[model samples]
Target: MSDGITKIKEEFDKKVAEIKALMKNPQQDTGLLSNSVDFRDKNLIYSNSDGVFTSSKDKIENYPAKGYPYKRGVKLSFSADGTTELEVEAGGGDDLYGICTDIDEFTGMATVVPITNNFTGYLTFKKNGNGVNPGDKLHFNAQGELEKNGGNDKSVNAIALSKVHKLTEELSIVLASVFGNRALKGN
Candidate 1:
């Protein structure tokens, strides 16, 4: 009887571990392909990846030092080909890649936008010049801002992890999950 109880406890623990793992990788735990998934705005102002739940102002001084800051941490003065030189071309490609997670309540300025992946979190980045819906799909335009997903362009960099509640406010910031690798393009 004791052995049976131990086995049951072990099985329960294993199932618990599996559920925790699923929550940690919300992006992957689902069977719905990125294309078929329908994202919705759940009004989640900030998640573990977005940093602390403080008023936007309080987060400003904390921004640069934060784990998933929007701006790129390093700049490349040379091309990846060892000694080939390159100039610092300004635009979008150099910054973070997901969606905007937080904006100042009063100023309406965007604050947090995480672009990279981690052992346990999703992220956000800026929007492209055009508008996007919650589940509309997205990718990096040449400038690096989130653009409509490229069907087969080899640059389909990400998928909208959540929907933007456009009726409430224009989606100045969006929450997204980056594609670890390039996925299919639509056109």
Candidate 2:
């Protein structure tokens, strides 16, 4: 009988440890929702004549010489039970520059706009543009003050975690109490 009780306790402890581990280091998945613009899709016009010198012909060249054209809507996902800090970064190829504007968090989407300041590496682009570079990545803390706003802010905050943890803890306590009572009765 004692051995059986010990086994049950061990099993409960092991399960609790697993849950704690998951809570401690939650999993996060990030995705690009949208980009800035399709530079290649734009038409560049020029006028020219065969015999006489004329304006250049319209050339449809892809911008961002290296990366894909920036789309309008872009987003990254960070998942956790509690509030988590986040950072955003961008790499400009040629004509592309860092986005400017509050990151919209309504739909977990980021709106990138063209800005004169260059962001090269890991730097915060929200408050000041001093350390900005050509291809710097932007960092967005929990405050959600970066060029993007909305969904990112909520996702990184503690609201979701607090709710989930509360429910989980309640369930755990109830389950433990029930199991303990049953053991006592059996004894």
Candidate 3:
């Protein structure tokens, strides 16, 4: 069973490579164009700035799931072992992180969007007693979720976009930025 699965995967990867090659070339042959429509419709094919063609969508990445079943919208960080492996814990000091968008249980991969400088997007955050108002400086709480009440030790640097009641499980959207020093300092 495993051998059959591996064969299927290999074939699929080969076809994907061919499709990527066709998309990269300036003049694509009609034959290669036949199977390319499906991928393009999903916005999965593109020629990147570095002149390499990849199927990865903009701002989305597939990383190996160190801990399987990462919940949708959970904050993620690169494990200490490598950059491509993802874990649910908040990274310590200067480490970059992303929000979980989806999880592929079959492949054990987690889809995430890396929070970069000036990135404006939605992230799941645990609400504090203040209930997270706009302009509140957010830092990673102990569980790797966002909270405005965090102390000086943790710094993820996300700002609340929409207000969430303290009764809610988490805040749904935030403006994540890596620039400047908007980090929360403990009182």
Candidate with better TM-score, 1 vs 3: 3
Per-residue lDDT of model 2, residues 101-153, tens digit only: 23334444333332322221111223433333332222233322222213422
Residue 158 of model 1, lDDT score: 55
Q: What is the C-alpha lDDT of each candidate?
A: 0.42, 0.27, 0.51
**True lDDT of residue 35, candidate 1:** 38
RMSD of each: 16.9, 29.0, 14.9
For model 3, how does the per-residue alpha-carbon lDDT over 1-187 read when each residue is reduced to its tens digit? 9999999999999999988875755366666445555434442431232122222434566676655423223355567766565465433234446545456779866665555423444454555435667766676544445566456555546666667534355444444433333544553
For model 3, name the residue pairs that clash: none
Per-candidate TM vs. native?
0.34, 0.17, 0.47
Ranking by TM-score: 3, 1, 2
lDDT of 1: 0.42
- Residue 179 deviation, candidate 3, in Å? 6.5
What is the Å distance of residue 89 in model 1 from its true position? Answer: 7.8
Per-model clash counts, in order, read 13, 32, 0
**TM-score, cand. 2:** 0.17
